[model samples]
Target chain A: MKAFEFLDEIGTVNTHTMVLDKGLGYAYVEDALKITGEYFDLLKYGWGTSILYDTEIIKAKNELYHSYDIKTYTGGTLFELANKQNKLGEYFEELDNLGFDAVEVSDGSTVIDPDIRENAIKQAKENGFYTLSEIGKKNPEKDHAYTTEQRIELINKDISNGSDMVIIEGRESGKNIGIYDEKGNVKTDEMTQIHENTPNEKVLWEAPQKNQQVELILKLGNNVNLGNINSNEIISLETLRRGLRGDTLGKIQK
Target chain B: MKAFEFLDEIGTVNTHTMVLDKGLGYAYVEDALKITGEYFDLLKYGWGTSILYDTEIIKAKNELYHSYDIKTYTGGTLFELANKQNKLGEYFEELDNLGFDAVEVSDGSTVIDPDIRENAIKQAKENGFYTLSEIGKKNPEKDHAYTTEQRIELINKDISNGSDMVIIEGRESGKNIGIYDEKGNVKTDEMTQIHENTPNEKVLWEAPQKNQQVELILKLGNNVNLGNINSNEIISLETLRRGLRGDTLGKIQK
Candidate 1:
């Protein structure tokens, strides 16, 4: 029952869009999902925000997302916090009890031994949860230390370690970080190199900016996996992927 | 009944927070209002977006906002569109019929003679609608043509011509336009000069960025009228006003 059905040019591309849910009210999410849910693939309760909200609300939100067939996971920061506390087992248990069907394993905010990172990924899979592992430091200085080759190695390692998908670190602000420059423009050479060498289909780029989303979609086709999209921009991003927006209009191939 | 009332140091300062609504679903508005309606002073259907949705939806949204005692109006772009089409009277009647009790009289996207601008403000008042006149151009090049004195003159004239409040243009992005620089930093000297000359209470600054919001709150007190705030940032802005967030914590006087 979508409006302008005749103009639905995006077609079935099997694109993955992971929306960032940073502490939104359940009713708001419910209503928003009604408008843009079918386009959504995954939902991340943004970094450490899951711990802030009432447990009942988180459970309700997880169930709501599940009803829409969107996989729900706590942000990587919570996992890092739990690892810091040496309560990884309890963290996994907490996620299950809260009805989250997915977990993101990331050492962005804190350090985790390579074995622990791999084990956590495997544990999440064993625990009947879809695992998304991220590879990048939250600190820009540390993030910059990894060469394109190093990033590729980490992405591959995570996938081999049983991650269903590995995410590239773009953070919420897609500026001067990872494959983006100071003005949030993509570093095309590095992007090309990474795409060529990595398991491209399993890699989700955290493109929080509109330009980044447009660039990625145009370069890699509309089926490109885009993550960290703001809740408000969900419908807008779908339009971009479909060439309905002016930015991507007449550019996306049906 | 608010959470952590003991931590609320803001002490109920009189403030006006105008949120930009770009075609939100009714259920989303209902849910959002439960969390933030009390904090909202006005809801603007951003930049001719009212024309895109069905009239029934617009009327429903206006009613929903009015239920929370929040005034609802279409964006200035709609006014400019009406002026361009020479449908001012029809536009005013349509707004009333559509259940919008307020109208924004602005020349952001198009030029209006001083007499016409003033007449529009007065006409809106005569029609029994709350009138808010905006005093900046939407295009940066055109906006830059107005000097501080010229801008101040417009503000004074708009108020004298019967504008309930005059909004300074910050156009969604709050960057390199008006009082903001290319980096979205506030131009302190220009801002100081404008504030000193204007009828401050009747002026609502459209500060969409976090830094701008923080800087304005710190300099002009938490009670300063702020417009063009994104819908999602309503509660966050309220927190900043009340000194609840880290940026404004210990900054605002109790």
Candidate 2:
């Protein structure tokens, strides 16, 4: 039913695009979904943004995303903030009341005991919410201290602790953070090492830049789950995955 | 009514924020404008993106933007493309049918003789369109050859030729091209020289970066006409103009 559905039929496609929705208005959510809803599966109302909106608008935006079968969740920063306030229970209750079907557990911006991190993941699952846990410090210095081996071990542990997916931190800027260099280019050696060790299906890499997205797709095949995509680039990214764009055209094969 | 109208009573604010809309869905525009429309004065369909969408959708989007009292215009690259193809007449007619009230003239990606550039500006004005003529080549290598004095000369010529406003090229990246270094920092010497010489009222600076926006506001006052702002940053830019944000807070007076 897509405009160029035949083009995508030429290859085997494996894509689970997770778009970041940072305080979208309900009308935008309603209308934008008609064009891009089918291409994305997960929607994250970006860090601490939902907290700034009224309960009514947040609820309305969540309902609209859900109407498209796009599972909606609050950003990891919100969960961290809730934990810092010792209101994790209140957070879960409020998320359910607002019709969010998932929760992101991240310690990127804060510190929590390992036991607490594991328990939060388990608790979200117990509450019938899809739990996504993130690994990597928000600060570049702290994030860089972890070797590829350490990140790999954490990804496996999070999966065993009942997280449906584990996100690797690539903040909105995507520069000098995690596997990206200062110029927003991928560190291929680190990326390859992690790719070889981690469960690809359970990991979502936040590739916010176009060059990063292109490199990830070309290196990991078209099905690599990419997160933090800007809303406007949804269609353009779809083209890259299907070899319809100049960057990936005839270069990608099933 | 704004969210924090009570806070901005300290000073008079002069700002004309122009946002770049590269093919947004009509629904998103309708919903998003409600949240941030009051902060912006112009909406530009970025560089040839309007030619990619249906004529009806383009017209509808223009109407939606105009409803918020935001003047709508196509990117100058589209004008250059049409001029290259010898379709300037058809392009103007189409823009009229699509309800666009303004047109941009530029020689960014192609060669336009000075006479043609001036005529294009005058022709657009003659066709009942508000004209915005841009100075600076799209190619950084080519753009760097022009001295600041030459740029000032072009700006004066464009205005004299009936361009309602003249834009300085910062091209979405805001780096190493016009009054910016490779790191996207403003070159103060060149900027100061141009500011001192140019007609400030008729010039729009396409500043796509936050640092650039902050610097311009600090140097030229909050009322400076700034273009190419991301849609999400409209409210944030307004806050900067009114000295409400941390960057410019308490630094400016009415």
Candidate 3:
């Protein structure tokens, strides 16, 4: 049982939290999960970092995350790399062998033909994986070129192509990307535009910063799907969601 | 043995690294220590977070750190709180019982009489604790009020009062405090003034950002003592010290 149960703030229900696991050791994940296990919905091996560690470790980490009922996936970079190498089939096979239940299909670092991107999402879904398609360029200049209308179209397109969820690219820094301004403050107009157009429940916003998390949660209700969270901030984010933290305290409506 | 031994980069030697632990669990520490334990010299329970967790957990963490030959201590805020409550003696006794081998003496959040500050350091040393004193206010405006000369005087004074090391406060943000500018850039003029005036070896710089770490490593050589390192960045910081990362690669001199 959690402390301060008398306060009776509604804890995480119908909200999805995806944490980024960037090369954390086995015992570390085990301990962190013991405290914040129920809070996480997804575990991402961030941005090609999975390739740096032994295959055994990745498989073990996948099993650990699975124990908490958290779906595991490699970052979009790995998928993009596989696509570039003409190894999409091999990539899916490798993911299956490694115990990943989800796949992120993105063209953040490299260009993918629109049809190919759609097919990847379809293929992932057909292969019994939860397909999450991302919409944004890794380069800030490239990312800024896409108008809100274009982003909305892509998000809709990806969902239509059988993506279980469409992720907005916030990157690790969460600065000057997608709907965030240079200082990481949410551009409310752009965020609202995207939210209004997209299926809000199917759209997961990659909010890495604390301020961004608070803003997104406050603006879109507690059930906002948030991703790319730092592993250490799992419990902190759960507190924010439950309105147990000062930022959202007494502000979250039941 | 560490990977990439053929590269033959000189690893950390005669340098101190102090990592912040803000309520991490036992197994987490054990796993992190197994990989990057040798890099750490001091483990600080950041701010007043220690009081928030169970005393048993704190004792276990302290023992775990000690096993890795890393000295553990509560943050200066706790010391400041003790000073405020006139429980300095009790604080020392509690630290002993908690198995902390070190203590940080600071007036960051509260005012301390210079005589009392000196006595606190002496008391900690007398109680067989490695005494660390921090300089700079927690408030940015108040911290900015101190001139370079005043900082030098305080640093020298703390050492004279038997401080094992004096930490130049950058806080966790590493911005607009001590020698860091608003953009978290190093104010080289102020940094040089303090370094030239004081015994550089006795001063540990709190640099929490990657840029700050790179700048400090390049400017002061790899042996410049750094504190307030996030637990996840331990391996990354060690790589910077060894000229393994792109930022400091081919830039660090023998």
Candidate 4:
């Protein structure tokens, strides 16, 4: 039973939240899971940080997330690095050995041929992994080049190509990427276009900022899938989802 | 033995880092300490977050921090809240019972008479607490009203009134407050004036941004005291201090 349980009875719906675990220690993950394990649906080991720690630690964290029935995967950068090295086969094998149940396929930091990108998604799904494909470049200039129509088309194509979910690239900063403006505010017109075209359940917005989360939730309803959330903000985000926080309080519709 | 020890063989010095603990779990604190515990000198329960958690959990966290020889205190907002209720004496007693060995005396969110502010610092010290008094308003507009000269005078006075450390408030956002501009960049002239007039060891700057941390480390020679650091960035800040991160790698002064 949560504190303020009476106030949070409304707006409790099936929502997907993917938290970024950027090189947190094993004990810390365990501690956080005790409180907020049920709130988050996916756990992402952020951008090449997994390679910095011992393989044993990574494996342990994966197993821990799995215990809570949460899907876990390495960041897309690691996958991109493996693809660049022509070691996708080895990467899939290592991911399985490391206990990862999901894989993020992205070309944010690198370019991949469309055929190869679709193939990566198929291979990840074939290997019994939850495949998440991302749209948008990490560089602001590169990301801004993609129109909303282009983003929506890619999101739909990835969903058709066997990605369990398509993640809009907000990066860790959540600034000037995908559907967000330079100040980290949501480009509502762009967002609505993507939402109207894509399957709502299959598209996860990588909203790392509070305003982004609130805006996404209010615009798309409480069940809007949000990703790239900082690990510390898990409980806080859950409150926002349930309209317990001031931002979404009395504003969330069932 | 830290990983990448070879790359971090330079710029080691005695420094004070106060991390903001905005309600972390027990195992999480233990896990963080296992990795970067020795790096931080103080742990502040951010704002009124402490009052929101159960007293037992707060006490346990305080004890946990103490075990690592890191002094723990509630944020200045809590101190001000207590002061508003005329419960300063009770606040000190409760702090002792909760295992906190430090207290922050400040009027960031409320007004405090000059004599009362001095008395609060003296009372905290008399209670054998490591007293920290802040020198900025929580509101950006009000904070900007303080001239560098006024800030310097207050800081010097706080130290004389028995504050173990005088903090220059940068808030959690670290923008448009104290020495930071709207873009969160350091106001070099204002920073220099404060640095020149105050006793460096007795002053702690609240710099929650990476750029602010890097700038302070480079300008103040790695030993400059920093506060309001995000708990997740403890290791990252340690890396910056030791010239391990790209931002400060070749720039840190001995």
Where is model 2 more than 4 Å wrong at Cα?
A1-28, A35-179, A187-206, A210-227, A232-254, B1-15, B22-38, B51-57, B242-254
After TM-score superposition, the amount by which residue B104's alpha carbon in candidate 1 deviates from its true location, in angstroms, is 4.0
- Residue B171, model 4: Cα distance from true site in angstroms: 3.4
Candidates 1 and 2 compared: the better one by lDDT is 1
Candidates ranked, most accurate by lDDT first: 3, 4, 1, 2
Q: Score the docking of each candidate (DockQ).
A: 0.08, 0.10, 0.08, 0.09
Candidate 3 lDDT tens digits, A136-189: 999999999999999999999999889998999999999999999999999999
The per-prediction CA RMSD against the true structure, in angstroms, equals 7.5, 7.5, 7.4, 7.6
lDDT of 4 by residue, B95-193 (tens): 887788999998887788999998888889999999999999876888889999999999999998889999999988898899999999999999999
Across B1-254, the per-residue lDDT of candidate 1 in tens digits comes to 33212221345568788999877789878876765677778989999889998888888888899999999999998899899899999999999999999999999988789989988999999999999999888888998998999998999989988999999999999987889988899988888888999888999999999889989999988898999999887766776786644346556787
Better candidate by TM-score, 1 or 2:
2
Across A1-254, the per-residue lDDT of candidate 2 in tens digits comes to 22111112334366678898777678766777665677788999898888898888888888788888889998899999899999999999999999899999999989999999999998999999988999899899999899989999999999999999999999988999999989899999999998999889989999999889999999998999999998887765775686544346456785
Q: What DockQ class does candidate 3 belong to?
A: incorrect
RMSD (CA, angstroms), candidate 4: 7.6
lDDT for each residue of candidate 4 in A1-254, tens digit (9 for 90 to 100) = 32211222353479789999888888778876766677788999998988897889888888899999999998999999999999999999999999999999999999999999999999999999999999999999999999889999999999999999999999999998888888998999999999999899999999999889989989999889999999888866776676544356446675
Question: What's the residue-level lDDT of A165 in candidate 3?
Answer: 89
Two-chain complex of model 2, DockQ on C-alpha atoms against the true structure: 0.10
Candidate 2 C-alpha lDDT tens digits along B1-254: 54566664545465567899855788777878888877888889776555445556677888888888899998776676567667788778878878999999988877888988888887899999988889988768999999999999999999989988889999877878898899999999998899999889899899999999999999998889999998888888887888888999887677
Q: How close is candidate 1 to the true structure, as a TM-score?
A: 0.61
Cα deviation of B38 in candidate 4 (Å)?
Answer: 6.6
Residue pairs of candidate 3 with colliding backbone atoms: none
